[model samples]
Target: MRKWLFWLILPLMVGCQLGAPDQNAPLPILGEFEVVNGDTIYHTIRDFSFINQDSQEVNNQTFAGKAYVVDFFFISCPTICPKVKKQMLRLYERFKDEDKLVLLSHTIDTEHDTIPRLKKFATDLGVGLPQWQFVTGVKDSIYGIANDYFSIAQEDPNAPGGFDHSGRLILVDPQRRVRAFCDGTDPKSVDQFMEDVERLLGEMK
Candidate 1:
């Protein structure tokens, strides 16, 4: 009877071990990303180059090996740009120490936001070295990257000084794939945004 009991217990323990998750395997990169009809949205960003606030050439691979948040804004904008920049400032304060996370802000008004202008904006916003990048480039290049990578809306009207865009932050993974997005104007969305970031980073570790 003791032998039969031991055999039964042995099988139960083996079954439990088999059902557990593998500790050595990496976790899935996406746990909260929205899937449409069981298909993940794989994005291909357009290749481009721009000058950052520090006058460094930033390109497609600038975000490699890290998860960075991106947004588009012009320093002269009187409306949502200030609010968005302030909110992004808060975000930078939270993750500034984490070398794996960074922030990139591209200017939509390339004609005016030159390297010096971008540098001044960064200084006014208190952006630190290697932590934040304010980028500007040819008018069409900046606009193209905004639409392609972030899926944000942007239209340049023929009217003088006329342009429209959406206020949204894009989260991109180390592989240049868009992972998540959030409305920059909404404070609640920032909370949810960080939650997803944590989830994604945890998977990579």
Candidate 2:
């Protein structure tokens, strides 16, 4: 297991042993931190700009004042991507009515996953912009941000579908801090992730 995955699960294990988690308690901001001048600084999502399915630019500001679920996948991914998308759709259905939440998916196969392809994919999935944004951008930029989300996205000839990536659905708070994440290929994990999403949303309120 990856180091970040261990950290994510450790809290859940402790919570189980200690009984239910405190509803009012804020979710832990995951990732590296540093102290400067006695003040702590948490890692945040780096600034990025990508064209969404609607041909509109999506950047950090697009999610301003809103919490969002993020994932990395290509429309053509043959292995875990479909499973991840199914779980992501569950999240979309559950929180589509919430005005403070959004979903962002980035395609690792930027060369083949062009704007028109992304638009068709979104349309076929019965989802649209503002609430759900399917974005594509420079290969380096897309793969680079995957690290910030604790996800894997890269090209490899031996990898299934010619790319290697992790099916992680990451949750980001309004402040751009990673609050929670789950194995997108596992339904049970996603169920727990939904609750985490609600917890974070409540915290934002």
* Span of ten consecutive residues with least summed lDDT in model 1: 25-34
Candidate number achieving the greatest TM-score relative to the actual structure: 2
Report lDDT per candidate. 0.70, 0.88
Question: Which tens-of-lDDT digit does each residue in 126-157 have in candidate 1?
Answer: 78668898888787777777756533435567
CA RMSD for every model?
14.2, 3.2
| Cα-lDDT of candidate 2 | 0.88
Model 1 — TM-score against the truth? 0.75
User: Model 2 RMSD to the real structure?
Assistant: 3.2
* Candidate 2 deviant stretches above 4 angstroms: 1-20
Q: What is candidate 2's lDDT per residue for 1-205, written digit by digit as tens?
A: 3456756775574345234557778787877777889988888899999999989999999999999999999988989999999999999999899999999999999999999999999999998878899999999999999988878899999998999998988999988888888889989888878888999998888
Residue 172 displacement in candidate 1 (angstroms) = 0.3
